[model samples]
Target: MGALGKENKDLTGVAIGISVLINVIGTFFFPRLLMVSGKEYGPAIIYGDYKNIWVYILSPILGAVSARILYKFLEVTKPAKPEPWHCNICNHNHLPFF
Candidate 1:
């Protein structure tokens, strides 16, 4: 999107936030909705067990949000002039091959 001149940082952040929310909801809620009530299956099925369900639900969201925060911090801290060869004092003869 940035290469195509459609760079909207706010939109990107919103999309990431929404996707994380949907993933958490689906992970914790979808399986229970699929199970049939009062029917005998091969074994008992459990969904959203209290022991670790919150961890499963929140970890992805926290990780993604933290990553975005880190990215934003790095973006703001990044130097405006990225090329080292632009400085005349540097001894480098030519730009390093990317």
Candidate 2:
């Protein structure tokens, strides 16, 4: 197994944490995407009050699970090294995301 460096570990952890927060906030926003016509489409689905609770609850659970799964992927992928670059626009070494 490839060992994660401190920066990667910290970055991954922060990403996971942010995902958790987004999922929590999304509980309110996502159900809004549901549309009702006695049919589910077109962004007008009315969430029953109980469904609201269900959504807020399940979303975070799923988010945490997804984060865990993503972490597993992170563990498997090799960390990329920053490439050295010289920029005429500015004098400094820089790396761009590939």
lDDT for model 2 comes to 0.59
Q: Who wins the lDDT comparison? A: 2
Residue pairs clashing in model 2 are: 34-45, 35-44, 35-45, 36-44, 36-45
Tens digit per residue, CA lDDT, model 2, 1-98 = 35776646668767857866765686587655322223332223444334334554465578669867987776645567888898778898778756
Q: Identify the leading candidate in terms of TM-score.
A: 2
Clashes of each: 0, 5
Question: Which ranges of candidate 2 are over 4 A from the true structure?
Answer: 1-7, 13-49, 76-98
State the TM-score for model 1: 0.31
Clash pairs, candidate 1, are none
Local distance difference test, each candidate: 0.52, 0.59
- For all predicted structures, in order, the TM-scores are 0.31, 0.37
For model 1 the local lDDT of residue 41 reads 26
Q: How does candidate 1 score on lDDT? A: 0.52
Model 1 clashes, total count: 0
